[model samples]
Target: MTARKRLFFMQLAGLILAFLVLEWLAGVFTARASLPYALSLLAYILPTLPLFGIIPLSLNYTNNNPDLPLSAHRMAPVRRYMVRMGVSMFFYVIILMASIVALDRFELSVQIKALLAVLTALPIGGIIWAVSRLIADPDVDEFERMIMTRSVMASAALTFFFAAIWGFLENFAEAPDFPLYLVVVVYFGLFGLVQPFVRRGFR
Candidate 1:
């Protein structure tokens, strides 16, 4: 195998090994064991560190460089991403507030509550799509696109794989049933982690 392909599979194997270790730890320890819980949480966060590098200018956005001009502060691309983030945040806050009010103020059925959450999630999806469109390369070559597609597929597979694994453990193994939202947070982070690996060794 090519170096890139080897690296990719190595990373994948490492992830699976870590999961297996965590599973064993969970199985060995009681539900209240904080050490296993903390280690499991660390495993999730560690894999996603590269995501901090892949997002739109998250790194240097906070750094202060003497050589950089003040004009960098007003760059259009930077402003655009910031605006995208702000708009999405505002809309999401509105949706969350409405959900809270509904749940706290009314005796809503499970179906209605789920429907409301789904409805709110649709706008968030649109916001993500719009932001991606704004920042994506307009003239990406075909090979690069294929690489990106692979990255996306890998990410989705990992997400579903772990989610199902965790779900099974929760139901049959007497492990914890973490909230759906928290699980999605980890999935999203994993999805973003795929971007840096795109187009690597595909040549």
Candidate 2:
């Protein structure tokens, strides 16, 4: 594999590992003492940043899309990847701050806070959709887009799966805590984290 592809794989693997480590650490720290409001927000925001890098790379653009100047053309691939990711980070942070404010300046209940973080994807995903289209190869971008779309749909379908199973166990068998937080884990946690590796295999 070329350097870019190798780096892509490394970044992706690192992202998955980071999510597992961070989620575990968050649990341990929250158990001992709750994370500060800002830190808590950061925890939810940080894990998804790696994916900003993945979106442009995953498009697998064989040639530069926008086409930089002749001097910059040689490094066009790296430059394009950086530009795409930079734009994504900008939007991600925007959504993060917006949701933080939307959650009543962090005054909301824990469940609502979690819900805001999970739902931020709705807008952020739109940014991803737009960015991916711009960066994708016209011929093959559709396939990549299809893969991404299916992954999202599958994750969403699993949400219903969890609802049915968890609801039955909770209502019929008397489970505690209601297990609603599992929604985030099932949708974004497992499928969200797992889909990149699956996408990587496509290249």
Candidate 3:
């Protein structure tokens, strides 16, 4: 196999492994311990991660390769994959919201939570698609790639720094109320902020 193909296969395998690990962890901790539910959720959710791979693959295949036309049959899988992901995310959201409601209610049934979770995931599907589109643009140029790489590295560094700080604060401070998610959101915003610098650096 070509290097590209090998990379794709490795990525695919890594995603599958990650999905399995998530499912196993969820099963062990959460009341939603059903294997089928875990597997289904993973199938629907994990595709979002590798949507990045699709952009590069599509660009590589289509650019300067008139003879190798975009195969509809091959592309069909990606569409189906996205659809599954959307459905899964939508239901997952519903489940979370419903669980919140269920906790308030008199009964606490696993089945009820599971059903509500699936129902909640519908709207989340739209958000997932939006996120996928935002990140995976087919027209990504060399400059964009550099920006994205640098942004990701910066984000990673920021995350590590924040994690260490949070750990220290927990140990030293009386009430450490660090908003980790907000820090992550800021890091995500930094991607856009650093884009100009990245472009200038390349120039």
Candidate 4:
């Protein structure tokens, strides 16, 4: 494999391993066990570190791959998209951690809690904006734009389908409640998952 592809896979593997380790440790600890706040936060954040690396590596791998056949014209928009996404995700981590720590360590007023919630949601807006800018960029080639658009549509469709099914199940079948905010994460994941197939079909 090329170095970029290898790096992407290694990062992906690291994320999976970290997740498994974290889950195992969580299982080992009793519900009543009191861990240090910093320790707990570190555990919460560790798996995500691999994701930061994986994002750019995956983008670079895809963009530079001979098999993908993207035009040189499209590369700039893709790079811009990557930068915006990376910045957004970085701030997401920081804001989310701060909000979590604040909520845990201090009893804030309702207004402050509401503000924290808004702050937590803000980075997702940046992600959405990044996608929009890429889609709407004049320099983006039609093929690239079409692929992104189709991937987004597919992601949205799948997300809605899953949410509708899970919502009914939760109401009628005693399934666990799914946090609505996580739908954004699922949508983004599906967006990535659909891209290879879309590109292959176009090829």
Candidate 5:
């Protein structure tokens, strides 16, 4: 495998390891009655930031596979997408951390708390903007666009299916309620998971 391919695989492994470690820490923090709010929030929030990196990485690897000869022209859209996502995710992490800290540290009014919540959700708009930009970008290869569309559809389907199952379980069996926000995470995960299968069909 080429260097990019090797780096991609290494990153993938590192991401999974980080996730497991973070999950364990979160569990430990949850079990402790005296854990700091900051630490507990970090345990929950930090795991999500790394996941955004995987999308652009996968896109780059797929378009510029070592075995495939890709031109600079072909690589531009991927590069652009990476930059957009990187910037968006960066702002998301910063804003989320600030919002969490502010909410925890200060005794704020209900209105302020609601405003903070709105501010925290604002960065998610960046994600939506990035995706919409990618779709509207004329520079992206037709093949890449098709792959992205299919992957998104598959991810959406899986997320909806999982949500339905969890909703029913919560209603009937007294299962733990699933956080609605985690649907985004589940969609992203399924996005990555379905890539290989989607590519196989085109191959």
Candidate 6:
């Protein structure tokens, strides 16, 4: 396979592995802790893993191809991809938010919320993958490829940095007391901030 494809596969595999690890750790914690709290914590933590996919999709859209720049007429495919991605993400956010709100109104079990979150994310992931495949130009040059690589690295670095900061705060403040949703907010915020960097690095 080509380097770019290889990078994409490797990054995807890494993400899957990370999610598995998180799931295992969460499972272990749940086994040891009170069931309700464990389920709630897992529900909040699990959604954040899929949020990482946004970085790759954003980088793909941003660094599509610089040399063979799209004509206004030829840009429709890219524009369509952007629109699809945007709409899918908006719906995903709305679903997640509504789920949280619903939890407030009803005695929605944490396991149910977690399952719904995962199911909702699957379609969003499909949309992102479809849009990326549709929009990415196969003729991307070496420099553009390098830019894409840097963007992915930058996104990973930023994700790690924010996660570390939150870990530190959680440790220092003894803030297991805080709502689980706050951690999800932090993850979403970091993912959003990193997208522009990914876009700018391509230019």
Among these predictions, the greatest TM-score belongs to 4
After superposition, the stretches of candidate 6 with alpha carbons farther than 4 Å from their true spots are: 1-69, 72-77, 123-136, 139-145, 172-203
lDDT for model 2, please. Answer: 0.61
Model 2 lDDT per residue over 44-100, tens place: 566555556555555544333333122344444445545655675667665765585
Instruction: Residues 76-171, candidate 4: write the lDDT tens digits.
Output: 787888899999988898788768866886889999999999999999999999999999999988877899999999899999999999999999
Candidate 3: which stretches are off by over 4 Å?
1-92, 106-139, 177-187, 200-203
Which candidate's lDDT is highest? 4
Give the 10-residue window scoring lowest on summed lDDT in candidate 4: 23-32
Q: TM-score of each candidate?
A: 0.48, 0.40, 0.38, 0.77, 0.74, 0.44
lDDT of each: 0.57, 0.61, 0.55, 0.82, 0.78, 0.59
In model 5, the worst 10-residue window by lDDT is 26-35
Question: Which is the better candidate, 1 or 3, if ranked by TM-score?
Answer: 1
Residue 174, model 1: lDDT of 94
Q: What's every prediction's RMSD, in angstroms?
A: 11.9, 8.1, 15.2, 3.8, 4.7, 15.1
- For residues 1-203, write the lDDT of model 3, one tens digit per residue: 66666765676667657656864554454444433444544433444444344444544544424544446654444454455555555555445534553464447578866666555555555544544453464544434445667766766677678678777888788556776535645665665576667668776
Rank order by TM-score, top first?
4, 5, 1, 6, 2, 3
lDDT of 5 at 70: 64
- Better model by lDDT: candidate 2 vs candidate 5: 5
Per-residue lDDT tens digits for candidate 1, residues 97-124, read 4665457557989999999888767667
* Per-residue lDDT of model 5, residues 1-203, tens digit only: 77787888999888868867876776677567555767766666776666666776677677768665667886776677777887787787767766776676679999998887787777777776787688668877788788888998999999999999999999999999898877877988898899889989989
TM-score of 3: 0.38
User: Model 1, residue 195: displacement in angstroms?
Assistant: 3.3
CA shift of 176, model 1, Å: 1.9
- Whichever of 3 and 6 has more lDDT, that candidate is 6
